[model samples]
Target: MAKLIVENGGPLYGEVQISGAKNAVLPLMAATLLTEEKCVIDGVPDLADVKVMKGMLENFGATVVDDGNGLLEITASQIRTVNGDRKLVTEMRASTVAMGPLLARCGKVVMPLPGGCAIGKRPIDLHLKGFRALGATVIEDDENEQVIVTAGPKGLVGDAIYLDFPSVGATENILMASTMAAGTTIIENAAKEPEIVDLANQLNKMGAKIKGAGTDTIRVTGVERMGGSIHSVIPDRIETGTFMLAAAITRGEILVKNALPGHVRPIIAKLKECGVEVETVDDGIYVNARDKELIATNIKTLPYPGFPTDIQSPFMAFLTTVKGKSEVKETVFENRFMHVNELNRMGADITIENRIAYIPGGKTLHGAKVRATDLRAGAAMVLAGLAAEGKTEVSEIYHIERGYEKFVEKFTGLGALLTRVDED
Candidate 1:
């Protein structure tokens, strides 16, 4: 295992360039199974999850070539198997996305239950429901813990599908599958994340007729065949928000480049409400929190265009030093507050009752040995360590690498006293 050792009390400075979206790249890679031509994706981040997805695709007989830059040329000219690797699927929940494209191309797919973070129970029942609505027979082998999906004799016939919740993964899986259906498909209450819009844009470039992406309703007209297209992924909004919170937590100044300012409006609004100064520059955003006392503010995590649940943990780390009491309500994942115990261990005054976390601010945090319960929680621990007064060691950094690209290098570029150390 690798651990991160962070020295406290260093204010981040200088400029940091944000990477491409992890959420967008995974589905885009899976979408390659929808075509037999060569699809080139630029600006793909070099991360653990991306590598995992690439390996899974290779196992399915796709030829993936990396240009040593951020470009990936994926050619699925031949698919040898419809069965996904059980171990790989268990390593990443995103592997479930293969079901859509695999069923569309091969007419059948069999894979083990996907796994990733231990945050909460994220059921794939919604995905199965969407598939069933699109004329696919979905069966679960409870004894073997596997899922098998097969299209009917007439193949996939598009129909109306409604989501009980705006689950991002479910929406993506259905949307991709519907693109190759026989008729039009309607997805109600779809996820409105920017990454969804990015995926839709790429699919359209590949000759898919998809409308109303980034809206409550999405309509997809099935196409006989999709040609290859070159597309650059959108910048990572979560990574951008992490850097912005890093600036505020360290009371530093940082200019974040290659970030979409409009994508993180809710986060910026909350930062301004907490006495942090944020301004939009020509191609990036500038953040300054120097010499300012942060005020406590209440935050509730919701769907896109609302406060993101992904940013909730990092924001909680910042709230520890605020002037008053602050409340964080997590509406997305039930077990997301696992970081609260770890944060409290570092001297943060926090209490959790049900889904709400009460943080009494103005408390000075000290360095402590902490385990990163998940990806976002690891980031929160790093933020807390940056603002603390001693050495902080964060273990289980593989979770962090699953999302962020060059995390330590980026933070170090911003003048953070952080380093990666190997632990045995």
Candidate 2:
């Protein structure tokens, strides 16, 4: 196991280059099954999640060549299998994305339930429902935790589908399947995340008709086949948000490069409300927060174009040092307050009931032994520690490293006294 030994109370100031979106890259890798030609993806983050997705695709008989310089060249032109290895599929939630492409291309697939951060529950019912609506049959083997889908003979036929919620995974599944279906498919209440838009752009490059991806309603016209092309994944906005929050918590200035400023409009606004100085340039975001007094701000987690749920934990970490009381409402997930207890261990005063969390700021915090309960929660701990009084030992750092590339390096570059160690 790895632990982060963080000596707190030091101001962090520097520039960080944001990586590709993990949320975008995973599904984009899965979308490769829509074509049999070569696809080269740029801005792909060197993350564990991306590695797992590569393993899943390799299991399906695709040739994956990581160019050793942050570029992945994948070709499924002669894919020899539709089913992925059960063990590999169960390790990453994004593996479920393979279902759409596999079924759309080979007509059948056998895969295990995907796994990832232990933050909340993910129901694949919507994913299965959309597949069924597109004329695919989904069967689950609970004993083995496998989802078996078969689409063939007559081929998939597109139809109008309505999702109860704007599930990102379900939206991706439908978008990929509809590309090869017989008729036009309209998906209502679809997810409007930048990742969804990135997937749509990639599919469009491969000859798929998809419109209005970053909106509530999406339209997809099924085509016979997709041709391969090269597309670059967008920079990871969540990573940018996390780093930007880190800079704020430490009362430091940081310029995060390669991140689109528009992608983080809501977060930038929230930070500005909290008295953090933000400047947007052509290629990056510069955060300046030399003032020690941080104003408390209320935040509510929502879908894309709004405050994202993925960055809530890290945002909460920033709120810990603000003056006065702050309120946070989580609408996306029920059990998202798992990080509250860990923060409390470090001398934070926080209360949670139902979907709302009340945080009273302006407390001096000292380091304590803390554990990470989820991916983003792990990031929250790192931010909290960077501003704490003394040494903070953050356990379960593997979770943080899984999502953030060179997290410690990023902090060290900013003159923070942080180190990674293999201590129990």
Q: What would the per-residue lDDT of candidate 1 be over residues 122-158, giving only the tens digit for each residue? A: 9999999999999999989889999999999988999
- Could you give the C-alpha RMSD of every candidate to the true structure, in order shown? 0.7, 1.2
Give me the candidate number with maximum lDDT.
Answer: 1
Off by over 4 Å in 1: none
lDDT for 130 in candidate 2 is 95
- Indicate the worst ten consecutive residues by lDDT in candidate 2: 83-92
The clash numbers for all candidates, in the given order, read 0, 1
The local distance difference test score of each candidate is: 0.94, 0.88
TM-score each candidate.
0.99, 0.98
lDDT of 1: 0.94
TM-score of 2: 0.98
In model 2, which runs have C-alpha deviations exceeding 4 angstroms?
Answer: none
